[model samples]
Target: MTRQHVLRFYVALIAALTLGVLGVGVVGVTYLSSQTLIRNLFPAALLIAVSWYGSQRRVLVSESDIWLMGTVGYIATLVLLPFPLAVLAVAASKGLAEATLLAKKQRHSWKGVTVNAGGTILGVAVGGGVFASLNGVSYLWSHQLDSVFALPLLLVMILLYNVTNELVVVGAITLTSQENPWSVFWRLSRAALIPEISLALVGIVFAVLYHSSPIMAAFIVVPVMFSLRAFESVATLRRETVEAVLRMAEHLDFRDTSTYEHSQRLADLTRRLASALELTPEHVEEIVLASRVHDLGKIGISNEILLKQGPLSEEEGDIMRKHPVIGAEILDSYSMFKSSVSIVRHHHERWDGKGYPEGLSGDHIPLGARIIAVADSFDAMTADRPYRKGLSVDDAVERLKAGMGTQYDPKLCAIFIQILMEEGIYAPSEAVPGELHLIAGGRASGGRAS
Candidate 1:
């Protein structure tokens, strides 16, 4: 389905889920008290503020994903309020905040707001229903040792809430990106699960404080806000580091346009291969990162050797091979990029043991490196170089097939070939190279050492 259709369907699904919960929630609404009703407003207003603040300083997950840090508010609502009231409060506050705060220029702003609001409503309603069913609310409202004893039930509530929220967000992302659903879900869960649990724990604290004295709960928001700011600061720092690396990669791209373009195409193909192989989100991200900077060591290569038109002489080749080690060393300084360092260093290593800095054969080489090798070889063959014309996509496939179990991991090569054929990109460059090359990073320089 088209993006709009998918979005419409998603919004419809959210509405259906929210309404389904609401039907049962109304029955539970009678459980709410006048004092509880008044208390609900505090969370609603706070959620509005949080949502507005979060929208302004969005955490970038990827082109298609944004990490929303409003879980505390939702969890607080679930803990302090019951059923329909909690769901209604979330919908009203989140909807108002998103409508006011979301950029007008963003596509599907209204529909996205609806999905966001409805998703929160469904999560709170369903989670609250489950919590109430297990008599979990007594833990938050009652005296000493209640919450301590009910820890297991509280955990279950958090899980259900997060799972519901994650499903809605993941479904939207999958629909919009047209990526594999399982991949999208895994990526979201890996990044989000810890933070969501932490926030839920904080929310429990908020609930406990509110039960003792509403004023105490109000005071806790200050520390919670500060903790969120710390999370944002760390995320910002990581983003800046990634940007710095990309800038360096762009500098390398400038040195040899072909090599840069080769990185770009190779990154794309490798990501496809990694995802196809069902690697974890973390591994997939590492492989994609390694593909982009696989030639980073080339940055250390002399201009004479780097810009050399023909195949390198044996001496030049020796210098060129050192790029992987140089690249890994450069990346090693950053803790966040450490996982990718091995992938970068080993990307050129061959399956049969003749390739690169490490002659470790087969599974001994990092799997990420193995995936990049297959993609790197394909992009190198198909990419247009100054000296020799790029091979046809068909010829590239033939080369990959021939190199199976030797130059490349046989499984990776086969999967990549299947990706090409399944996508009908037998001649990608002719149709739309820009659209086919779908990873972040800039421009073309196709050559890389085989």
Candidate 2:
């Protein structure tokens, strides 16, 4: 079956199970005292409203994951209300948010809202039920657990709730999106994990004070929300700035003939290589950002030169060579992109001091720029251009090997060739010692001229 069909089936099954659970909770309200119900209902409703607001002001964490504060709302509710009540409150919050979205003329997707709510409620049900089974509803409804001093159990209970919540949420997200649930978990679990622990601690502290003064408990939420907003602004600015860089790169293909994806492929490979080299995540990310706009200077070159079917004239070549400096100058204006500016300016530099712009040699060139230079050269050879046909994979590898000491970093080029051979991008049979030696130096770079 198609992926959409698969998702629909899962959604239907989840909806049925969720509805049944909520139905059972509704039927068992007789077991809850009116006083108990009255005490829990307002906090539940208030948290629901708060969660809906958070959902509206969510932050994107990845292409797949988002940082929504709804879990913060649910965690607070789960610690103070019964398991059934927690589920109902969380679900009600989602339902209410959808209504608000509709009122505002936004697309309140049923799949987006329902699956997420259902998964969250399911997780709370599992966690809280386990907590109640072990200690009854004492912690759920009283201040006793607050002073228990049994830190381990309290932390364990909090962890159980958060972990269950994460698994369910990820599953729902996986079903709705193209990303693998496990991969998404591994990638973002850390980002969300720390925040979840901090928020859970906040909830536990708030729950303790809640019994003393509901108004004070209410007051705590305002600062927390504002703090999150402040943090969100910084994170959002970074993401939006990266997006703007990508949008600027799209200008490379003004008439729809530019090899825009060439930059994308180079960026992907450059990041991969940086990671393979065991570079820090920060350096890898900087390399990625630089690769995205490495060709930005091409925008300043006239279309006549860019679209030329033959070799560039000396003047045209001169204009083409200025792209790296132009790109670096443009990026230098943005202080936030300082990490990438050097890489853009020096991506054309050579290990043997024959490269353009500054002609920086060897390790004198930034590692990020060296990585991009290799990636850029490989992509240029492999990609079909108006002036030349694309080279075969073997020819590209051979050409990169030829340029290793002069045009590329010898260590990185050797490593890159090894990677290509291992991935079978180049024939494994060609990986004999004779070929290996050729990668580092023995052969003349001018042995085969284009």
The most accurate candidate by TM-score is: 1
Candidate 1: list runs displaced more than 4 Å.
1-11, 30-66, 101-103, 107-111, 175-178, 247-292, 297-309, 312-450
Largest lDDT belongs to which candidate?
1
Per-candidate local distance difference test: 0.71, 0.70
Clashing pairs in 2: none
Q: What is the alpha-carbon lDDT for the whole of candidate 1?
A: 0.71
The CA lDDT at 341 in model 2 is 86
- Candidate 1 residue-wise lDDT, 1-450, digit = tens: 545576688788787876776666666666768787686767666655654454454566443335565676667766766656766666666665566566564535666666666767777766777887788877655678775757887888888888887788777766654446775677567767877788778777776787677778778768677767867776778778877887787797677877667777787888787776545455577678767777777889999999999889999999999989999999999855776798889888888999989897987888788888888888888888888899989888778767878888775666576577567776433432332222211111221101
User: By summed lDDT, which 10 consecutive residues of candidate 2 come out lowest?
Assistant: 441-450
Model 2 C-alpha RMSD to native:
12.7
Cα shift from native, residue 130, model 1 (Å) = 2.4
Q: Candidate 2: where is the Cα deviation over 4 Å?
A: 60-65, 102-108, 136-146, 149-154, 172-179, 233-450
